[model samples]
Target: MTTIDPGAELKARIAEIKERFAIESAGGKLTVRRDDGLYRHLEVEMPKSSAYWFEVMTWPGALAITGHTGSHIFRRDEDMLLFFRTCMGPGPDWKIDTRYWAEKVQPDGIGSTGVQSYAEDRVKAYIKQAAQEAEADHPGLLAEVEEELFSRYSKADLETEAGAKAALAAFEFDGFRFDTAGWEFTEYDYWFLYTCQALAWTVAQYDARVQVAA
Candidate 1:
């Protein structure tokens, strides 16, 4: 049997991410260390001027960012990228908070994510959770659902009451039915799906500015 190596995949992805961002061109530094050929740790230091400095570090499942203002730990790459993106720019809004995901660097009660978008992300997370929980209560239910949907995902949507009802409506087999009326969405940071391209433009802009100043 051939074994697929997740660490190898992650190494390639991380390398691709760095190349896509072109961090060095912006006078930023991104360094990585490997263990037994598996990409393991990462550290990032954005170009520092009198007004700004930021850093990012990651290991295994955890990622952290720090700025002059504050720092935070993040589990989701989307959250990390979006927050970091928030701090790169030309003015008050661009200042790094602590880690420089330094996003909007808003005080409590302020957020960079849009209201509807935040709600949607919450709904999606809630649904995925509900599906997993329901499956735990009814083993093999998810396998059946996956078979029906022809998707390889481990779970299904079931966050809102309406969505839960829709899930019930979608599949009914003998004694199989999804019960998710009581599932509740947990609110948290609103983050976007991350891509290196999402951050490349800002890096390019920063690099150009530094070059002109030089």
Candidate 2:
């Protein structure tokens, strides 16, 4: 399908959110609310009949959401969107940084490590090429080699350089080569398969948390 660009996509989503919601900010607090939207069409906190809205909060190491609607946790077709960034830890602009998660893959910052997140198309093409070259060098080489390794030695034996070299000798037969290192993994990128899961969990936390608070 389509490739992912997490940072760009996040920004776009934030912009669209701005268009649909009214945002209020002061010091360590922020609020996002909507005017014309009703609460029935949305998945909200099920308030006991009152106004409804939605919110998203962010800081150095925290993110949260809160809202209400027409009545009884008024659900709405479109949600109120409020985004907050405090002047607490880091500077005001884009406070979330390397510490927000891991380096390299997550934030697209490559320093000493040679880490990179690959697009699906490139990954697929690379796999196809590597497979073609590998099969050409020796048919069923990878599978046969694995079976031979297990049949020849125990896990301890394979731990040694000599044992590993011997077991994987097929890889060096005539001229077989492949990039053994795959692309890097990160939570920040939309390409990350877990993006949806993570977002759902964030909202779930808000749901559980507000329920307890109320």
Candidate 3:
């Protein structure tokens, strides 16, 4: 079996997206149009950290051009390209910091003190489902995933309660108002694992698209 280099594959995918969609950027905004002439405008906001957040609005009407909007945050340029590709396809419904984590950590009817417990329960549930799927479908890819994880995060960094709190602090973003101090150490580790899973799934989706086009 051939080992997949995610960095190289991501670069190629980004290039293909630029060529196929005629993506253009100017004055902090990236723009692209669909084959049907619907246009998407992405406004990016760069924070002090390397991660950038974006809000995208799409317009379908020729005269009025009214459509919905969505937002996402990406830690790298390659992630932004994958975001664009997913937008062109089914339109991404996932909002990492704002929607997903917020809902998990602060579900409806939950008070402040319940946040950690709620998040822990949800993470535990997700891990069980994720492990089953990973074992069944992609056992061969686990080592590569682990290597990528270690490159981004130290084992020591994820093993302790203090490290878990620090990881949450480092990854905190605007519009995601939460108290990381309340989060359990296991929750932090699960968050990192979940992020890696999401990234791998996105790359797989992009690869599938490429194969279908070919």
Candidate 4:
């Protein structure tokens, strides 16, 4: 079998996502939605300034105008699971930073990095447990899911040094930062914008598959 470069695959996927979903401002708000009956409709919303920053930020001054207000609605268990698996990870410790929502939901609540990490870790644990139960109940379904994931993102390539470096560079160029605690998603960051695109692409693929199966 021909080995695929994980970094190359990831770069290609990101490019494809960017092309597939052209982020446009919907007045003062930007919303991307995909409704597939087999999966929950994926709905993501952010401020127009935030979208502009992601799509057309040329200088640091542009950052001053963007707000980090955003919302993600995953209405079904399968949609959430797919998100965790594809965007976050299928690994036991993988997590999605919820700091933006956390701050909005409880501004006076514990707002330290440690607190956010702990909260995300707890959520990861629950996702992992649920995934395990799902795998047990579905027999070969887990393998199928893994296969599908691999087709899109090859693990072997990502493990290679070059691939790892490329992935890091891509994230950093998009303004992601890592500290002792973990990766941080800055306000109006490129990573979040890319994630919105990725989720939309994934939902479209799922919708296509559902149509074919039906």
- Best lDDT goes to which candidate? 1
lDDT of 2 by residue, 1-214 (tens): 1244445655664445433332211111212232222221213321323343234333333333334311111111133111111211333223222222223122213332212233333333443455555775678755543444444553423444344434334334335544435422222333121222222333344434455769
**Residues 34-122 of candidate 1: C-alpha lDDT, one tens digit per residue:** 22221233444556454344444545444444544235454534433333445454542333232223232223346433211223343
Q: Ten residues in a row with the worst lDDT in model 1? A: 187-196
List the RMSD of every prediction in angstroms: 15.3, 15.1, 19.4, 21.5
Best by TM-score: 1
Give the clashing residue pairs of candidate 3, or none. none
- 1 against 4, candidate with superior lDDT: 1
Candidate 4 structure, TM-score to reference = 0.21
TM-score of each: 0.26, 0.25, 0.19, 0.21
lDDT of 4 at 96: 41
Residue pairs in collision within model 1: 65-99, 66-98, 66-99, 67-98, 67-99, 69-97, 70-97, 70-98, 83-101, 84-101
lDDT of each: 0.42, 0.33, 0.34, 0.34
Question: Model 2, which residues run further than 4 Å from truth?
Answer: 1-61, 64-81, 84-133, 139-144, 148-171, 181-214
Clash count, predicted structure 4: 0
